[model samples]
Target: MSDNYSIARYLISQLRPGLQLGETVLSPDGKVLLYAGTILTEKHIEKLSYYNCEGVRVRELQSGVGMGFDSNQQRKRGNAEPEELIVSHEYYEADMAATVSEQETEFAGIYGNVVKDLKRCFTIVRLEKHLDCELLQSIVDALLTLSERGIGATALLHTATRSEDYLFHHSVNVGILANIIGNLSGAFKPSQQRNLILAGILHDIGKLEIPVHVLYKKGSLDEDELHMVRQHPAIAFKFFRRFKEIPESVRLGVLQHHERDDGSGYPLQTAGAKNHPIAKVLGIADVYDAMTSKKVYGEEVSPFAALDTIQADSFSGKFSPKYSTPFLHELCQTLIGRYVTLNDGSTGQLVFWNRSGKETCLIRFSDGQVIDIMNQNKLKVIKLVC
Candidate 1:
């Protein structure tokens, strides 16, 4: 075995009955193979005897003794090829390690200077216009790297502080999500992707102008407070006008993200064709992060659930029809083949998309069993595991 082999690789051999440490298990050709982890109990020996395993031998590693099996007997029993077994172990280990590393990095990035920088942005709306160009570029670069690695930007949306820190995290997450949407939709060239990122980063700049109390309120807002909230887009637009170098697409996204396709939204209340494509994409990404985020008043919804809400609301004319359908479809497709932990504590991969229905499709086990959740009346998806 290679010195670098992971622990998972060492545990891949099939078990047989009566296997004992230090005893030689022989093949039909009298070759030795397979190792046992420890001395076999009578029950274990009986189980392997039923499988007709010849005998067990033990080999000790740095950690402990491993039981060995008869090679010829294993071949007859249809054991997986050694190469295939090793590859499977390696793949599993790599995936688990990457996930752990990502989680660590996300938590670390949430502290100290990074948090201070984000908090500063939240406290001053004008900072959006004056934001260090290099820093904005660095954030965009990091997002693109994450996309290439198939890591969800949502993983970076950490809420270490219960205050208005979510606003800062939300802003960053929206930026990353918007950039991803733009890239996936083919709405921009490589050169334009950064601009979309910037548009996403600044889309909610006007919210900084809202009183911190209103922004972080634990209670429901009254009608007058709600009206004040509606003026953010106009405030954002005014702020953007001061920066001549900012792209028009970015400026438009900041001003028009609040406007609905059906003219039900606020600020300018533009209808139909008036909303820009980048703005529409930004609006979708922004709402998704907000709805799925945990707050004082409510727990976060799953991403899949948020997607469903967006689709339902869009079909009801809450958003522009021109962009909503394609956007939702792409979002659903992006999530296919991903694993999610259901509320019932079962983990399964998302195998299908039910575009027309409320419940999505899932494949629950390794046996390829199909569960059409849309028709499964007793069960519902309660969470989306990253």
Candidate 2:
């Protein structure tokens, strides 16, 4: 309720070198402990840990481009002729704030840059015999940097409104998610993890050979079109064979990503023993990207809904329980602290997840009330909030 704060807020983690404090730091009881414009020092940040503070409010950070204090709050900074003060307030991440416009601007910056890089890489692989794996790694590195800062896949999914360049978008999305799954798999070697990411990048490369009309069709494909569509894995597999420099994991992953444990998958219909492990990772991430991304015919499903469909298939032996289950568990870990909109028209931060059951999640509302959503039978997390 105090006008003494900036609407743009930050977590304690954002307290890095060159971060200037924009407002007076206050105790929970409103007692001023630090003055306005006190540039945060290591000691000051270290003090926060002692207090067990979850986060701190600050003005825009004087850091980098697209980074800083909120310009809107700068109007209220000091003594002025008008002295207009803001009453009700909403606190949000300084980097990603309480404003829709601010979040959109940030997300657009990420989307445009990554999509451009992917387009270039896709073109390189299509036109040449050699693939620049480093360029692809650079894309994953950029996305990983954002994820390290807590602006991960869920945030991107929330910000994206449409799929303008669908292929590139899908490649980058699946790459980011595949790495997340691979890291948590506990069995994938570091090289295997890197290969998993590569697999995601090239998994759908064969689609390029398909006619644009069939590839981007807004309606169900005819039998002929469907048969052509399912040939993507084989197409990519054969194309990559020209480049002996490519990893076997990547080549086979490209070939087998659609292959299911139950043998109902496409191209080769390879299953179980024949399925490359990295392809299993690719399979899950691919389904997630497809479900949550805007398609020509249907709207994107929520992350939870996508998982529901995959898990159902997993139950029917479509995906290996040993593989798909862990992927789901680890992937869901990323959602623990994210905000979600519920079916009952309420919004909350996911505070806890019950390991024994998937449906029950503990969520904390804006008022700080934590509720186990499983008991609220009619309530389900309908979508993730940006």
Candidate 3:
């Protein structure tokens, strides 16, 4: 591991299930293999052994630490100040040498609940050809509701770690994102909005047909595996094509989301106005979420970087400007004043967005120095930080 990593080292045997990763673990080639805050599972441990890695790094304990909220104490205190509950790198780094504390256990328990509920919902989808709309809606509503309570979308997404069962978690994210975009664009009626959410939920229904060993593999995929994965959209389209209950917009979303404007995507080389508008939005949402979320192999880019890539794709004729322009503009507005982890491992505030520039942004560091990130081609914003 690099010396700049923000984590405490623990022996391989010392790491047990339920421990959260303090920072992202990288491959020998520097790609992010696992994201920070991901909960440990047996599969993860096995993979660690497969790579012959040494000890692992876990999140620093926060007992009696400043800026690290003591949830139990806060509950007894009635109402705590904003500063009292906020978690910060200063406090965590200061207490890195401290022993594992009880607060993380409680935090993990809360996250575990979200994961379990999500698993239940996905299992229902697998058994039935269609999702239990009410159950699925309830879970997504809870997530959105939490976001409304000032937790933000990333916080709610974090509750369901990216370490296990990515397909289901991804479906839930895309569903939430699709609903947000649809509602914000004022492009759909209330009924239309609900259907759009359902479409996002079932967009990857074909992936379930893929084998478990292949679906959850750790390393790079072989050509045959890649070919199988690419067939998912067509498989999904076939599955629900004759189901009268499924909406046309939804069926179109599942079938055409992977299609590109320039006729570059798989299954069908769909181009221009041929792709459905809803699918275009789904494609953007899908890419945005996947880029930000932890992955099985590739490195996760920061929100701004993801948007930049999407913007480049739009300019390259891979995505429609009709859908990508408004959506990216709206999303970028939400990112102003947010903190992000830089490629050089420094944390900075996103001060501005360059709408006309080749580079994406200008960021302000803690030391009162501002850097235009676009000038450095190799730099990447790792993730958005609260």
Cα RMSD of all models vs. native, in order, equals 14.8, 11.3, 16.4
The TM-score of predicted model 3 comes to: 0.64
Q: Candidate 2 at 88: error in angstroms?
A: 13
Identify the leading candidate in terms of TM-score: 2
* CA lDDT of every candidate: 0.57, 0.65, 0.63
Candidate 2 residues lying further than 4 Å off, grouped into runs, are 1-111, 124-162, 344-346, 355-358, 363-373
Q: Which stretches of candidate 3 lie over 4 Å from their true place?
A: 1-88, 91-118, 125-134, 137-161, 241-243, 357-360, 375-380
Tens-place lDDT per residue, model 2, 15-59, is 763244444454665433443333354666776666666666554
lDDT for 163 in candidate 2 is 73
Using lDDT as the measure, name the better of candidate 2 and candidate 3.
2
The candidate 3 region of ten consecutive residues with least summed lDDT is 65-74
Evaluate model 2: give its lDDT.
0.65
Residue lDDT tens for model 1, 67-172:
2222222211113244322222342233224333333354445433344565565544445446555555565666555443222344334333233467666666
Q: How are the candidates ranked when ordered by TM-score, highest leading? A: 2, 3, 1
Which candidate would rank higher by lDDT, 1 or 2? 2
Comparing 1 with 3 on lDDT, the higher-scoring candidate is 3
